[model samples]
Target: MYSKGWIMMELTMNWITLRVRNLEASLDFYHRILGLPVERRFESRGKQIVMLGIEGQPKLELIEGSDPPVKPECGVSVGFEVASLDKAMAELAKEGIPVARGPIAPNPSLRFFYILDPDGFEVQLAEHM
Candidate 1:
């Protein structure tokens, strides 16, 4: 007999893998600039993929690919919700990393900044009060 009260689970993303041109450079941006830690790294099929973790959260996999996609200029921005916009900007400035857009208080309750990764991908640093 078939069950009538069971709920089916759907497939979900365990990790997000970004195809990048340079694996090491991409990893460094995420680790150094973005402040993500390397959770695990290994190789498969002669290609390398590095997984990054932020605190206790599951991380992203930066994979080396032959033909990297040209990431959209003004769409689907990868936003990193930060603890402090000033702190983040300070750290980035110390490392000689300049934000394309400096920290701005758009309103009384929020602020954000923007920077480009080595591959020219946009990263938005957001803070909420």
Candidate 2:
């Protein structure tokens, strides 16, 4: 027999998985350009999954698929906070990644910009002002 009340369980984010058209290119963009370290790589159920992130942090998982979802031009976006937006933008420029939109300030305390990943996914980079 088991008594049921409120079972407290430790919960934290594990990963954010995105379906990608090209695993190698996506991996290069994230691992080389964005500088996320490769956490692990493995194949499961005929699909290849690559995980990237800093150790002990939430990861971004790239799953290989023939028909991945098309990223909308203006609806959905993923965001990341950076220490310095200037440095991030400069690094991105050096890599030939164009800013799709703003280095706009949504508010006085925050600045952000947008860029498209290899799979056409929009990524937002922000810094606290």
Please report the candidate that would top lDDT against the real structure: 2
TM-score of each: 0.78, 0.85
lDDT of each: 0.79, 0.87
**Candidate 2, position 44, lDDT:** 86
lDDT of 2 by residue, 7-126 (tens): 535566888888888899999998899888999999988889999998998999999976655566646666788999999999999999999999899799999999998878888999
RMSD of 1: 5.0
Residue 38 CA displacement from its true place in model 1, Å? 0.8
Compute the lDDT for candidate 1.
0.79
Model 1 TM-score is 0.78
Q: 35-115 in candidate 1: lDDT tens per residue?
A: 788888899888888988775665677888776556747354567788888999999988888988767788999999889
Q: RMSD of each candidate? A: 5.0, 4.5
Candidate 2 weakest lDDT stretch, 10 residues: 2-11
